[model samples]
Target: MLKMKSTCERCRAALTLSEQAYICSYECTFCPDCTEALSQRCPNCQGDLVLRPPRTRSPTEAPSLGFKAKLEDFLYRA
Candidate 1:
């Protein structure tokens, strides 16, 4: 789950969970506005910046339960 991280890594602007942001391999985060203004290179990893998935409350509040359910759902389907 996403923590209380609410700032862009570059501009340090506030970023809500619903905001479009990019995250590097190392999870270095930046807002889309900042990323678009600059090249789509991760400042930390220098790798491609990927869109971060929205974090759900269950991931943070009930990590084990959510993880187990997701894993089981995938495993049994196969």
Candidate 2:
């Protein structure tokens, strides 16, 4: 799964799930401003930065806690 990072790596700007962002193959995330500044290239890997797909899911929906949460719940119950 895409980590869907919440901030721009360069400027530390907040990036919402539905907002326009950019990423490279290595998932180096950036805001539109920074992306333009860098000429759509990933500073870390020197790869092309492309538009990240916006998440279509509603923001109000709760995020899953994944495997660690399940394991913790089971341990607590036991």
Query: Who wins the TM-score comparison?
Result: 2
Best by lDDT: 2
- Give the poorly placed runs of model 2, Cα more than 4 Å off: 58-78
lDDT of 2 by residue, 1-78 (tens): 786889999999999898999999999999999999999989999999999999977544656488977997999999
CA lDDT for candidate 1: 0.76
lDDT of 1 by residue, 20-63 (tens): 78887777888898788658888777888778877544344654
Give the per-residue Cα lDDT of candidate 1 at 13.
93
Model 1 — which ten-residue stretch has the worst lDDT?
55-64
> Local distance difference test, per candidate?
0.76, 0.92
Which residue ranges in model 1 land beyond 4 Å of their true spot?
1-4, 56-58, 62-78
Residue 61 of candidate 1: its Cα lDDT? 64
Clashing residue pairs in candidate 2 are none
